[model samples]
Target: MTVGTAGDPVDRSRTVGAVGERRLIVELTRAATADDPSTTADAHDIVIGSGDDAAVIDTAGPAVISTDTAVQGRHFRLDWSDARTVGARAVVQSAADIAAMGGRTTGIVVSIACPSDTTVGTVLDLNAGIVAAAHGLGGRVLGGDLVDADQVVLTVTTLGALDGAEPIVVGGARPGDVLAVTGNMLGASAAGLALLIDAERRGDVELLRRHARLVDAHLLPAPDLGQGPIAARAGAHAMTDISDGLVEELITMAAASGTRLAITSDRIPVGDEIRSAAAALDTDLRDWTVAGGEDHELLAAFPPHAVPSGWTRIGEVLEGTGVLVDGRPAGGLRGWQSFGG
Candidate 1:
């Protein structure tokens, strides 16, 4: 019901309203800075930064920048995720955008808004998550803003260096290029979500334990940030990650490339864990593998010969447009969009 520093009045711990915005920001910045130290070069790039009005960053080469946001109920539920998980996920998702562009992420700026009733500990944990994700990926949290809102809302702007390579966009695939994937196959997170939904209905503790891995996957997803750069190095012509659904992102890649992508269902990797979860719910794991989103695996296009090691070939580009699964039109399996099409 409440949280606060030791010896603080019990009533003061009941709500974050007791703390002023300025004080909260000072403490939050310190926590984030401690996790992502200013000793790094990017931190030095800031001529006037955090604690000031804005951030000043200098990049030597081509820079690819991207921003992503996560809203409390829309992106995650407090019941399903703690503040730390939400913060980390918000940062990682934005960083993925940079990686998808074949960039070396240098740093990030995090922006967070939460209701006043939110606890200070929650905010600190959330900042910790953002800092951990960025710093762990060789990126730093340069600065951010904290504001009052009705619910938790997080936005992260990620900055990266192209490192001399051309920024890989989503439309560069050519006919005859190989369609491949780097990182784990799709549906683990969706499967986790499915399990969580089922658990909500059943309230089966044993069942939740049995399917713990899947639930955790949905709660805390770790995107494969390294593969984008690797794919770029291997001469990826086009690339996108499976953030919405595999089918959805593949369609985007196809539309951008002006080519048709043909995928075989059997080729999409489905592990024992996902398969087991699907069976329990009487759901088809294949459906999740094809349509489920948020796995964050790098799906890319490479020349047949240039496809790198560790990249698994899933399909190929053709002369037409759109996506096909096993030569059939993917009418039902599509990625998610914010608004209904």
Candidate 2:
């Protein structure tokens, strides 16, 4: 039986949904590719959009490139996170690496793998998320590949330009350099996960929202994109993104620079959200603050009195190797490893 004419209500709805998704993808693609006119020339030389297997980009100067992956079960769960959020997370985290290098993100290439059962709607939403994140960083997705797999996985590679700035390598730190951070630490994503695990648990839903920022932070972390350039402008000695636990990343920097780092527990910033969540979980907020991964904040070292505004001093570079928390070895798990428990 005909509910209406050939162009009936159901048909109209389906058409609208399809159009909306297409529009969303176009808008996202535009946003992702939009860049400063001056920078556009640089990106244009490398990109072959409109038709290509992978977008081409000119890797002039010391082009900073970084890649990151997000897996369904380990990095996200479909039951908890929507596809849009998952897509954005993939772009954000990868871009953060470029920002940490005191470089500007110019382009991205994303590879997505998903099960056949994944909905077309979900795939569009994921694309929207990726476009939004790339836009936020003043970069664009040049091209990528899609494939079928047992699980959903997104791998993103970000390309950046140093713009004549000195690459802030992890090895530049020296004794007497001051260690500092550009953003909050610990427990946002962890807290959100706790709530998702048991929604009935006594935690504020608003806190959950804040914790979801970690989802974005973990997935779509807005690294202080401008801060990297600012740090470089201010003569940052050394810098690295705090993707691994703060302590573990510090140890890595220390080793790279052939210096020791000592951080005081009292100096690390612990947010109330993290503190309260830690209490509820019977975990130490300090541990998460120091050892948690995926914060994506920039940890950097500067010569004494050379720090910039918006950065807080957390420790100092010492004359040896290894990292110390309040003058002792950080004895817990050193940091996060992709294959390690």
Clash counts per candidate, in order, are: 2, 5
Candidate 1, after superposition: displacement of residue 225 in Å? 0.7
Q: In model 2, which regions exceed 4 Å deviation? A: 1-47, 58-60, 185-187, 198-220, 331-341
Per-residue accuracy of model 2 over 24-65 as CA lDDT, tens digit each: 334334434453232544445454641244566775677999
TM-score of each predicted structure versus truth:
0.90, 0.81
Residue 22, model 2: Cα distance from true site in angstroms: 15
| Model 2 TM-score (2 dp) | 0.81
Model 1 segments more than 4 A misplaced? 1-14, 37-49, 332-341
Give the winner by lDDT: 1
Q: For model 1, how does the per-residue alpha-carbon lDDT over 120-214 read when each residue is reduced to its tens digit?
A: 88887798888888878887777888788999989999999887788899999999999987656468889888877788888865666887877
| Alpha carbon lDDT at 176, candidate 2 | 93
Model 2: colliding residue pairs: 46-56, 46-57, 46-58, 89-219, 89-220
